[model samples]
Target: MVARYVVSPRGGRRAYPSIASALRAAAARGRPALIEIAAGRYEESLVAQGDVRLVAADGPGSVVVNQLRGTVLQTYGSVQVDGLVLTNRDTEYDVVSCWQGSLTLDNVEVRTPGGVGTHARPNTRATLRNSVFLHGRTLFTASAGTIERCRFTDAADNAVAIIEGAQVSVRGSRIEGSRIHGVRVCDARAEVVGCELTGTGNAALMADTRAELAVADCVITAVHAEGIMFIEQSRGSVDRARVTDARHGVGAASGADPVVRDSVFTACRDTGINVQTDARGRFEDCRVVGARNIGVFSTKGGAPEVHGCHISGGNVGVAITEGARGRFTRIRIEDLTTTALRIFDPDSTGVFEDVRVDRCPAGLEVRGNGGTTAEVTRAEFHDFDQAAVALAGQCRVTLTGVTADRGMLGLGIGEEAQLRAFDCRVTRVSSGGAVVFGSARLIAKNLTVSGSEALGICGRNSALLDITHGEFTDCALVGAAFDDECTGRLVDCSVGGTGDMAVRHNGLVDLASLTTSLPVVRNREPVPLPPTIINVINIINQKIITGPTIHGDAINNNFAWGNDHVIQNQPTEEGPRT
Candidate 1:
């Protein structure tokens, strides 16, 4: 309908700028209308009644709205402001407020004449796409909208704070020089993508108030505080992002579970990934290097997955204790002053599959009240002052395909530990050779120990030791010595020595086909296993009846022991021979 015109500052003299006149005309029409603002200085306050579109005749720096008092535009309905420069706005309140409306601003700017701290709500409710919100407390608050390709600099508070049931998408934006957080999203769903944020007092991106925020392909550098902080049951995921030179790269606390994947966090003052307060999350394929405290810390009942990641250069590479259970695979960590992996106090569960630590202070340290169970496979260690793997305090651990070379002690099974090492290699050590013991029970198979100074296998103050399929080569000391009530059964194993001693054991054996020239047992008694002898007799009877007993336990003398299974002598008429 051919709209009516009502010029503001309402005079017949036609005195205000054309923008004020056009707004008056659009309001007079009482419907959806377009206000064509010419390239000039419009000094006035605008209040929209209904749906309106404010179109500028020039670009962002051309068409200017010079407001000295305070607000420039306050709207009630859906509005669109395009291609305008709004300068010298109010520092007290907002320059533009879309209280009940949605705003779309393209190439628009709202800057204060004062310093960076300018407006309270620079642009609210608003989709500020391709806009520059400079010198404000907040660029915008999209309560239920999107903001794309926007830049917010020198903000007194958060550059962008999305709240109030709003699901905002801030993409391809830059938030820098913030007094507080760069982008804060709380009580809402937020997805921040392809953004660069730096120089924040708080976190670069903070997700609180039970919101789910996903940050992808973003770069956060030189953050004065944490790079990303997730709290209050917020489920956040940070992927393909880089967080460097921050106090903390990522922190997920207060019952929040945040996942970080394919991200790199380097040169952080605190931990690279710290999860506290029952935070259950996953970190896949991430690299955390040069952290001041810990590479990955899971405290207070947080169960996290750390897979295919590299953590290096920290006080502790991975500290999972105090009820923190972490599942790890393919984690390569090394070169730390204290504890490569520490699982202590209240029994943490860590499943390390194919994890390697090269030259750390203490390797795989576990202690405390509740026991930690780990399925370690294909793990290798080299060049350590202490034991390669140490387990203490009633813990149950299993090691398969583990190799330890050039260490003071290969494996230290502390008192009350039930450890099983299968197909493990311990070689080239000066002090303690394969094991220095204080364990309850230790079952080992296919153990290769070469060039050790002390006893090859020493289980002191421990109860049971089952060693099978072992090769102890070129050792001057006793190959197998069980002291302090330690008893073992050795079978199908060779203990070779350069000088004299071979299989100087203090244990018992049953039905062992020991190929060594020396006897398998030294001080302990040796007996025939009934199951082995019966199977042998049955095999001989079968050879007389038909053919050989192929794949029989007696043929190979199956004598493997693990942590899960009990090591027992074969049933005999001598009442369970040991």
Candidate 2:
């Protein structure tokens, strides 16, 4: 049986006069011992060993131990401290410390004046439950620990800091009014679950410098900087978090890649979620509401994959720029003041599939020169202002099953770019519909432009427009206009229904089986076709490119635009010239 020693300032009935004498007696007796103290204040520096249990006889808040020069209690054995107030008056000392032992604090309050509240060193194991800390950080250095149901307030620095390969788990803790980050984990692994962090001066939760973090069901609010950030090669996962009124809701930079899922960010001042500077983060099933700046910004080697997310009420919805690569699938962009999505990198494929953008000022933009082909599939744009869909900067863009409605312009390709559209439709266009200019090439198949107030399709400035099986209806001025060294070809195309002219041709244009209302057909004679040319267009728009040594795919023989296909030597209506 373990011996019990009673300690009281007023000595009576075989009780020790001071806690120090009681601890000396327990240590001399050896084995496991219990030191119960009466209601009093003891001024002493103590070292508890040999499986000691320090309990307050009159319960918590009754026993106060103030160490004036050093730690209040340093434990070397398995020590259990219950219902005691531990305080250190010196700034250079800690209230409670465990260096190479197991320590448990239950129902304890640590009040330190300019000192650490609780410290567990590299070889220690600490567990704190139902505790309170004030004006100091609960630090763990290369230690293994768990903090449960603890409250930390008015912290001088981070409320909890875990560093140097520490493995810690904090559950059901509230860290509020921290001067710096609420919780910082560097070069360690931390799992924080069911925690609430409020009013932090810096990032609410930060995992930096190769640390790993997994946070779930947490609330972070009123942060001066990022709510949750991971930087410097750190990777983590966040689930079901709510971040409100932060500068940036979530940020990943400098090789950090965090997969955040099912989170909501509200009223962020800057970008709601930012992945930049070689960071590759994935966001899935998240909602960003009322962001003042861009909703999602990825740039500078940042490659992010966002899936099944909704972004609403931001200045710009999503901006991917400066060699960044972004792939968005099943995303909803709603009611932004600026463009919905912009992709400026030349090497980015900009894969966007099953996206809906409503009431944005502009739609998707793919810009830059010598770019790989960007593929967008099943994208819908509604009520956009100038560019419902615009492709510029000599880039290559491919649109399949895309639709635009009730916009100022629907689908424009300019700036020497090349566009290949398949099964696309634009309706209720107010200003213009399907315009191509500036030495560009637009190869459209199964395209429909209906209910347009101005020109249905206009081509200019050496533009090559290949339209096959297209329907242009309800156009005002002209259905299809080609001019200024434009090479235009239309096969099985119809132009009618409330248009002034069916076809206005001022360039080198050839038409076959064109059904129109009033066709002013010029250059109707059959012209000999040119040779199979693999020239600038092939160089600008090709996935598997060919050079002088590597003979490319012949344009007319193998690849052709619909019925204008040419076989090697098959003689048809248009004789083979190859």
Q: What are the clash counts of all predictions, listed in order?
A: 2, 0
- Give per-residue CA lDDT, model 2, range 1-578, as digits (tens): 88999998988898999887887888888879988999999898888887889999999879998877888888888899998988887778788889778899988999876558899999788999998998888989999999999999988888899999998999999999889988999999999999999899999999999999998999989888999999999989999999999999999999999999999999999989999999989999999998898888888888889999899998888877777778899989999987787777566557889999999977877777666457889999999866677777678888999999988667777767889989998888775567776787899998888888776777766788999998999877667766556777888888768776566665366667677655443333321111211222222233111223114343544321212222111112332122
lDDT of 1 by residue, 1-578 (tens): 53433233333444344566676667777888766555666677777667787767555666777778767777777778888777664566677766665677788887764333212132346677888887675433335667788888878778877765567788999999887898887887889999999999899999998988999999999999999989889998999999999998988888888888899999999889888888777899998999998998888888788889898887788888787788889999988776677776666777888888888856777665545666688888888766677766677788899988887667766557677889999888654455534445678889888887655765544457777898877665556555545566767777666623555444333326444433333433322222322322232233211235333334535322112122323322222223
Query: Residue 304 CA error for candidate 1 (Å)?
Result: 0.4
Each model's TM-score, in the order given? Answer: 0.79, 0.86
Off by over 4 Å in 2: 113-115, 345-349, 518-578
Best by TM-score: 2
Location of the lowest summed lDDT over 10 successive residues in candidate 1: 559-568
